[model samples]
Target: MEVTNLVVLPAVLAFFVLCLYFITKVVRLGKHPNLNLPPGRLGWPIVGETFDFMRTMNEGNVLRFIQERVEKYDARVFKTSMFGDPVVVFCGPAGNKFLFSNENKNVQVWWPSSVRKLLRLSLVNKVGDEAKMVRRLLMSFLNAETLRNYLPKMDSIAQRHIDTYWEGKEQVFVYPIVQLYTFELACCLFLSIEDSDHISKLSLKFDEFLKGMIGFPLNIPGTRFHRAMKAADAIRKEIRMILKKRKVDLEEKRASATQDLLSHMLVTSDPSGRFTTEMEIIDNILLLLFAGHDTSRSVLSLVMKYLGQLPHVFEHVLKEQLEISQGKEAGQLLQLEDVQKMKYSWNVASEVMRLSPPVSGAYREAKEDFTYADYNIPKGWKLHWNTGSSHKDPALFSNPETFDASRFEGAGPTPFSYVPFGGGPRMCLGQEFARLEILVFMHNIVKRFKWDLVIPDEKFKYDPMLEPVEGLAIRLHPSHF
Candidate 1:
């Protein structure tokens, strides 16, 4: 009886000890580390603060959302949940520097689920070595030197676009027409596709696609997301068809490998002989078409609005562009050198971008647990760097609300403070292209017409992109050269 009792008691104790050990481990798993997270509520679960964020965005004062929180929390970095994710909002130049400088080290580029779904396989969705390779490939064609060769083409397209669309019209809707101009340029330079009918059709589809890009991700039929998905499908199908024909042309030696972006993408491969997949190429083409044109179109449309509102600013831009025009022969297209001479004009565009940046902010996902602003940031959390944080800061720019082109002159706003195109390794690949595009558009439009806003008090909103609510109708009075 003693032997049996001893054996049973040892077994029972061993079982109880094992159970206690697991119980301790399970409790530990349920509790997170003692983290000093930034102040602010995550709002309701799942839905979160997305409603407030979207409401402010639609109201054309998205920065107000950030500012209110900054005041409420009294912190540069605050925690909030947006679009169903816990996000840490980083405000000011210090925050911007931390995120921009630490790309792929502590954090990585991340887009919302919607963007990831739509822009799959594009460079924005890629990271590390693969992203680097794709960027290098695109830079090969989009770099300033290569784009310089296309200046004559861009100039010709601008002139023809103005002549065809704005020549005799007394009043015009600036947004749609500018979109047409930018899309046409994209089609011409990217794929060498110049058919007006085709471009017009593609532009309509692209409008649907853009509308759905930042829309709520409800994929039910009749919803914006559903329509955007359909439009994307149609556009991709068309591109695939184009790719098929181009491949045959390339194989038969009927097309030059250096003819256009599509051709360049097709024939080029990484040093290891790895060529981009057909679908990858198609996806990137779509990405470029959207990025390359949409932001520039937005900037150009607003430039017209601002120039009309502020005549003194307009006169300065006009005077600068006129000097460039005066140096050229009759009907001469703008050259690379001509664009370089439009320093003052570029500054005006820069100021407009600063005042009303097309992209409000960008997102990055923490690769691992990190600390910022004395607050612990957990792994997998999203971090946002807002343009308004710096762009609208009184400390960064004096009287930040006022429009001032001279701010960009000489040294310009402090580094990382004016990131209309972002910064670091992931800075915009098309920034130089955008600079040239905006300058050329300015040179052409200001040189030809002095305009007035039909809706003198036009209101605009950021529907995930800044756009005039009324499409910015304007009256055109041709300039007598």
Candidate 2:
């Protein structure tokens, strides 16, 4: 009796009290006072619906999760819990519009703990005046005007990539080669690191660096994320060394201010008379290289896949390329006007992005209490918008699964519905750059060969972005033959 009273009784009593506390909290969570929140289940304690959210997305069926809830509730908005936070799902064009238009006013960008931890210098983590300043500086280099100047160089690189990787091959896995091409292109355009040996060494490290950007934030040894963090640190060190040399080049007039992003960063200053630090510039460089290569690589692979599977489309693309080729002399690079003339080719790429967007959605955090879709949204709640729900919605695009590039023919899918490059003030800064790279690659490859996929039944996985489960491999037949 003494033993029971001293230890066991108190232990059991404490356990009961803890259970009672959780029960009370759960009861409180189910009731939101007078606020009319959207209809949905929070699911399980502490963990909430995080596993369901991750599992569905991991399975590459993010749209299914959103569509099911919308169907059952007949509501465009719903409440759910994800990543240990309350999230408000805003579906369709309306949801996209709200998030894109409301940046910094009612909401600002948010990311998972993993991304925030790994990508420390990214502008995505900044807010208010700071974000605006960083964006302006980056835009100075990435805007349409500046990117247009790189078209000839992009054309040259695309031609070289084909000659080096695709020209002599009987069969090749396109994803890896395309990755090498885009990453090398990014290095050339962003850092002017055109030396094959240097770019090759960096590219090997960057593969591991990118894996960390989306991996779990755990920093333990023997983990991919840990390896990623180390790779990121090493890359930063290399960029810093380059920056040191660039400062001398800039000071001595050995490099032009507009030569590369590094030179541009060296000369530019923010609105508040702030010049970026070496570390900050390295972060921006890493961020740009990361974003610039991944999206184009994915899109380029899918472009190859679709063009290969559809013969008529391939003929049309080839015809467009041949027309462009006829005007230019042998070995001459494509001019900006030549790229602009790729209307049909652009439409095809746009359609592929719609079917399998590289970046599906992003997160936002509410600034204050607000009302959306007649539902009360409390402050501090996480906001999410998925392109898949809108892209695959039958109402937005008729026969959404059908591969009709013509769907982008006239004025394209409705506003906010076609967000391959995202939209509004915070839209992808590298959109124009990506366009030039993809169109140039398409032009060069089509004029050379019409390929057929070796793996027709290949699967796509989303490591938060579209990646082929197996690198997309194909066999090429010369277009002239």
Enumerate clash totals for all models, in the order shown.
0, 0
Q: Write the per-residue lDDT of candidate 1 for residues 1-481, one digit (tens) a residue.
A: 9878765776667456645644553354246657798999878645569899888878777889999999998899999977667899999999999999999899999988778888888998998888889999999999999999899999998888998999888999999999888898889889999999999999999999988887446565556877888898899999999999999999999988988999999999999999999999999999999998999999999999999999999999889988888899998888899998999998999999899999888999999989987898888888999998899999999999899999988999999889999999899999988888888888888877889999898888887689999999999999856
For model 2, residues 202-297, the per-residue Cα lDDT tens digits are 888888877666533556555677788899888888888988999998899898999999999889887667789887889889888889898899
TM-score of each: 0.93, 0.91
Off by over 4 Å in 1: 1-30
Q: Which parts of model 2 are misplaced by more than 4 Å?
A: 1-32
Report residue 270 deviation for candidate 1 (angstroms): 0.9
Give candidate 2's TM-score: 0.91
Q: How displaced is residue 375 in candidate 1, in Å? A: 0.7
Error of 1 at 380 (Å): 0.4
Local distance difference test values of all predictions, in order: 0.88, 0.83
lDDT of 2: 0.83
